[model samples]
Target: MADLNSLLDDLAAESAELEALVAPLPPEQWARPTPAAGWTIAHQIGHLTWTDEVATLAATDARTGSTDFTELLTEAAPRIATFVDDAAALAAGAPVPELLQRWQDGRAVLAEALRAVPADAKVAWFGPPMRPGSMATARLMETWAHGQDVADALGIRREPTDRLRAVAHIGVRTRDFAYAVRELPPPADEFRVELTAPSGAQWSWGPADAAQRISGSALDFCLLVTQRRHPDDLALQATGKQAMEWLTIAQAFAGPPGTGREAGVFS
Candidate 1:
C-alpha cells in the first residue's frame, strides 16, 4: 500500500501530465467532442475541476471536524443520479482559461488539504469513508480517467505509466461496489486478477489459485474499469463464468454505472 505522501505525489504527477496535454489547446479545440457522447474537452476538464473542489471541501471539513461534507451529501442525495452531469455541464460553461485555472488551483488545494488530514482520520466521500492515502488514490483514479477523455478529444495518445498502478488497484478493490450499484450480488469467491504493467512487471491480486481469473495488460484493465473503452476492444482475457460477466459491467469510479462506450466506436 502506498503511503499518503507517495500517493499524493503520484496524484500530482498524473494531473501535471494531463495538464500538459490540455494547457496548449486553442479555444476551438476545447469544444471538440470526446468519446463521451455529449461531453467535450471542456466538459472533461470541467468535471475534474468540479470534483477536485468537492474533494478539497471534504478533506478540509474532515480536518476541522465539521459536518459540512455530510450535510452536503445529504443535500445531494435526492439528485444523486443527475448531479454529476449537471455539475460538469455548469463548469464547462466557464471560459476555457478560467476552467483551466480552477482545475489547476483546485487540485493543488485538494492535495494540501489531504496532506493535513490526520493519519487516523477517515474522510467522507461519495462512497465509504477513506483514509487520506485512499482518498488520494481515488483522486488519482478520477484524474486519469477524465484525462483519457481529454486525450481522446484531442486525438492524442498518452503513454501508460507506473502511476496506473494506483488506478488498477482501485479498479480491483471496487469490484464489489460495481456489483452493488447494479443491484446484483457479487460472486461468492474471490477472482484472481493479473496484469502486465507497462514495464512488463506482473501485478496480481487475490489468491493465486482462485478459480475465476482476469489477465491482460494493466492499461486495458484500467481502461475497462473506467469505462473508457469497450471490453471487446481491449486485450483482456477472463476465465470462468462470473469473471466474464464482470468484464461487461466493471466500473472503478463512484456514481451510477456509466453509459459505457459502444464496442468498435473507437476501434
Candidate 2:
C-alpha cells in the first residue's frame, strides 16, 4: 500500500519547505508554542529529526525498531510522557539552525536507506511491519502533519500542493488502522472516499458504489486525518453511519487515538 518513490520525493519537499520557513525566523520564534499545546516550533522539528533517524535505522538495519508502538495505545488520551516525548524535549534546546541541519541530514540518510531495500520487503516498526514503500509513506505522513503545526504556529497559510496526494493516500489507506488503534472492530462494509486534488483532479479509493462514502477537497480530508483541523472546519461530507463515525476519530499517524482539536478552536 505504498508508493515509495513519490513518498520519498514528498518527504524531501516537505522537509525543505519547513526548513525554509524556520531558517529565517528570529531565535525567539523557535521557542514559541504551536497549537499542539505545550510543544514549541523547535519541539515539533525536534521530534521530526528524531523520528527520521529511527525510521532510517529500521529500514537499513537487520533488527526492526526498538519499542512496541501499540503498547502505548491504551494510554492514548492523556498521553503520558514516554521516551519519544523526552527525546524531543531534550533536542528542543539545540540552536534552530542546528536542528534544521540535523533534520536535513537524517532524512537524506533515510531516503538512501529506503531506496536500497527491496520494495516488498517488510521493515520492522513499533506497531507492525511495513514494506519499504509503506515505511516511507508513514514517514512522509508524519513530516507533513508536523509541518502543518509549524505552519499554523508561524501564521503562514501554505497553498496545498500535489505532494498532498501522497498524504491523502495514506489517510485513506489507514482507515482500518485508525479503527484498530481504538480497539474497535472495523466495519464490515467498505466506504467510498473521493477527494479533489489541488490541480482540480479527482482522486478516490474503495468501491464507487459503497453504501458509505466521504467526499470533499483533498486538503480538507488530509487535515481531518492528520488531526490538524477539526472535521467541523473542513468541507467533508459523510453519507453512512460508518463514514460519519470515521470522520470523528480518523487518524493517519500511528500510536493512540489522538485527542483532536476542539471545534472552533482553530480559525
Candidate 3:
C-alpha cells in the first residue's frame, strides 16, 4: 500500500488535470451530456464536488474523533441509493464557475483533513471505515472516473498516465465488494492481475500461480473497472470462468450495480 502522503500528492495531480480540462470550457459547454444518461459535464463536476464535501466530513471526523460523519451516514442510510444523484442534480444548478470553484476548494480541504487523521484510525464512510491512504485512493478513483465522463463529453481522448495505477489498485481491491453489491458469492480464490503500465513497467497483484488471472494494458483495466467502457471494447483477457464473470459486473466505485456502458459505444 502506498503511504498516505504520496497518495495525497497523486490525488492532487489527478484533480488538477481534470480541473484544467474543464476550467477553460465556455459556460454553454457545461451542459454537454456525458456517457452517463442525463448527466452533463456540469453534473459530473457537481457530483465530484458533493462527494468531496462528504469525504471531508469523514476525514474531519476521523481527525477530531467526532461523530459528525456517523450522524451523516445514519441520516442518509434510508436514502443512500438516491442521495448521490440527488446531490449532483442539486449542485448542477450552480453557475459553472461556482461549481468549479466549489470542487477545487472542497478537495483541498479534504486533503488537509485526511493528512491530519491519526495513523491507526479508520474514518467512517458510506460503505466502510477507511484509513487515510484508502480514503485518498477512493477519492482518486472517483475523480478519474468522473473525469472520464467530462472528457468523453468534450470528445477528448486523454493519454493514459501512471496515475491510473491508483485507479487500477482500487479496482483490484474492490473485487469482493462488486460481488457483494449484486448479492452474489465472491470467488473463493484470488485472481492474478497483470497489466503493462503506460511507463512500460509491469504491475501485478495476487499470487503469480493463481489459477484465475486477468492480463491487459493498465488503461483498459482501469476503464473496465470504472465502467467507463464496456468489456467487449477492451482487450482484457480472463483465464477462468469466474474471472470472466467478474469482468461483466466489475465496478470500482461504491454504489448499486451500475448499468455500465454499452458494448461497442466506444468502438
lDDT of 2 by residue, 1-267 (tens): 436787788778888888888888888999989988789999998999988877777776523443443343344435544666776897888987788789888989989988887766777766577888788788877888898999999888988887888788889888888989899999887789999999999998999989999999999999999999999888899999899999998998877788878888776
lDDT of 3 by residue, 97-159 (tens): 899889999989998999998989998887778888999999999999999999888889998
In order of listing, the candidates' clash counts read 0, 0, 0
Q: Candidate 1 — what's its lDDT? A: 0.92
Clashing pairs in 1: none
Judging by lDDT, tell me the better candidate of 1 and 2.
1
Model 3 lDDT at residue 164: 88
Q: Give the higher-TM-score candidate: 2 or 3.
A: 3
Which stretches of model 2 miss by more than 4 angstroms? 1-3, 62-81
Model 3 per-residue lDDT at 8:
92
Cα lDDT over the full model 2: 0.83
Question: What's the lDDT for all of these models?
Answer: 0.92, 0.83, 0.92
Rank all candidate structures by their lDDT, best first, as comma-separated numbers: 3, 1, 2
TM-score of 1: 0.97
Candidate 2: 10-residue stretch with minimal lDDT: 68-77
